[model samples]
Target: MKNYNLRSTDEHLNNLTSWLPNQTVSERLANTGFNIKYFEKLPSVINHCLPLLSALLERYDSRERCFIFNGIKCGFFLEDVYYCTGLPVDGVEVTGVVKSNNDEKEEICRMYLGVSGLLTKGKISLKNLRDRFINAEDTDYYTRAYLLYVIGSFIVPDKTGRSVDVMFLEQLKDIDKTGTFAWGAALLAHLHVELETASESSLAGHSYSLMIWAFLHIPKLLKLLPNTGRKGPDEFPLLVQWTNWLSLDLKNNFHKNLKSKFSDILDNLKDEDIVWQPYKNLQNLPNDHPQHRENFLCRTVLICYNEVVYHRPDLCPKQYGIDKPEYSGVRKEIAIYKKQRKLSGEIDWSKYTSEKGKVDYSKYIQEWKHRSESLLKEALGVEEHSGPTLSSTPSSIGNVRYDCSNTHFEDDEPEVEPLQPPPSEDATPRTQADASPKTPDDGHGSGGEEITWNTFYLAFSGQAHHSTG
Candidate 1:
């Protein structure tokens, strides 16, 4: 537990390079490229190291350390390092620092930026993070989630509106499997919706596309969500069912091709896809490219969704449902996705809107048996029912045949012996003494009494019949 609070510049400099005394700063920079182990260790030294990083960044004539302009932080990129102010303090918020300009500073800047690149989304999107920090063989859900969070931190959209970090949008292209890092991806999606719905500019349209991306990935997201950490048993399943209902509801409200259009947007997003920028708007985006059509499809789908929720007010959950979603950030995401999708169309008043998907609460309940019988059978290596046998006598009850060849000794209950038919009137009745030793008691007259035909039949059925004198 090393103390993270470093007060002075000397202390900061000392803490930053104290690990290796013999090797020069230039030596360390050339050797260390940046990995998870180093990034995890940054927190303890970040407060101290950032000032040195800022000073080093100033050495590059192209880059300058601009922490606050007009009392607000400007989003500045120092080679690969990103610095911002007024957002959640990820590393260090530089207030006051001395500036230095020289070629010698470049080596230190390279070392700091290498680590910083791993943090910032502008430098390392989810795709870059996966390639750099995570090994190709890794597939564990928890590990992917942890990595997504650490990387997602720097994606904080510029609240100052000075510049927009749209590089995070590249994550949409790499989301091949939503279930792998669902919770983390959901959190990131929620952040986008919040920013988009809050805006009144053309950026809102792009934000809508991000929301649709989240919707498209809902299937994998639902499947991967860890069940135990949820607030209630119904929460997780109910979310799935609700998302399912809303997805179809939005599609049915518009034309069925809206579904295909949504899919088209996903399919077209590539590493080279053109995303809108703060400095240069859609003006730079050519009308002929694949990116143009992708953006068009996104807006088209968004317009359709918003129109239905607008006129048909009951379709919005906030107006009617007890479970208001605004608290959890879901309502805003859903509302924006629905709101931005609004387009001009004739209202089909007769279209079905009442069928809300049902949540299987029992499936998520911890105590309930969620594992299928087949799964248990496969695990235990025991067959539930034996294979069919040769034809046998049918039971008197119905068409069910009692196959004697396939006898089951599975259940604990004792088997009953077959009942004998009633004897004819002329046949002599056997006394109890003459009966076999294994014969069960008739529960009527004493053992010495004669066993009558009616008595035998009644006893076999477990019902006694008293004869009239």
Candidate 2:
């Protein structure tokens, strides 16, 4: 594997916690379903498992958009994002162009940041935001500023890593509606884009999600840490499950030890070594947990503003306890259609129909429409294997068992397979959020041409035999 380094946002995230809101504001945030109280307790510095990340990236098939672990298909899913970050999944999509003019932007800055001329070069410094809002008296403005800091520093940070774009102010303007945006989906979309370029040199955009996912799915990694006897509740937004759970070993040789142990686990990986459904027993998930969005998890496009990436949950049917179908990559035509849509000028997604939008994503729409049939087939006593096997692969790590003796995971709950809830009448996996409409002459208009599902299905029926792999 080629040498690669992770540009983690742990330091920024840890420092920003110092500005966490008081109980009143925290409660208010929780009411909005954007609780981030767990962040304040995160360790000052997180020692990421670099060796494991490197190995995973090495096996990442960018074209297929999943990691091929010993020929077994696996990748992060939308469900993983909801479980890991505790962010909402179902709501208005988090995609829109920043249409606020300079006067409007400055007005927002004055109200939230308590400064008139803070928008320097179209961005605000993290330090400036912290110093201004850390001790502000107005609870409303203080909460808004702190949220901006959290998003800029930790959630959707760019490569620069020190500043936040002013565009997010629009979302925070209506705090009550903040939770209405699918923050979890946006985070996953950004991370997917980062992973596509991870092979180059430096990694960015929420690497913690990937790290936690690895440890969760592959239990062997947890054996490297000494048990601290700390256990978080088994619930949604599962990252909270590890709050103050383990301390990082700062010794120089820690990486070397981690690398060695991870290699051993992979070498001896068995058919049952992976945890297909880690959140099977999670209790009392919020009403808006996006369980209905499961069908859209695969064969869909994830949109975070301009970042568009394909999600192929179809590649790993075992994760959902469904039988694996013949492997087929994303269709070339669908890929091209997504690319073309991305290049089209700023979209007025509010006017664009998600189910039957201007773009032709009928292939994905049909697959999602039939997702229930596949699950029903499995539920009817069809034989299902655990997953692909690695028994034929040679290994040098001798006699290692991939077990979870050192961790707090319990095996009491019968791993119940998750089924996609029946689709609603107007249910369509929303790929993007609603934005302000633009004029027809602005190059953003769809020229009054809309592709209905009937037309899309008719066009797609002829190409049904073409492989999507």
In angstroms, how far off is 16's CA in candidate 2? 4.1
What tens-digit string does per-residue lDDT give for candidate 2 at 165-260? Answer: 665666677877677775665666666655554423344466555767777777876776555323334655555444334333321234445655
Q: After superposition, how far is residue 409 of candidate 2 from its true place, in Å?
A: 45
Query: Which parts of model 1 have CA positions greater than 4 angstroms off?
Result: 1-123, 134-146, 149-234, 250-469
Give the TM-scores of the predictions, in the order they appear.
Answer: 0.18, 0.67
Q: Best lDDT goes to which candidate?
A: 2
| Candidate 1 accuracy as TM-score | 0.18
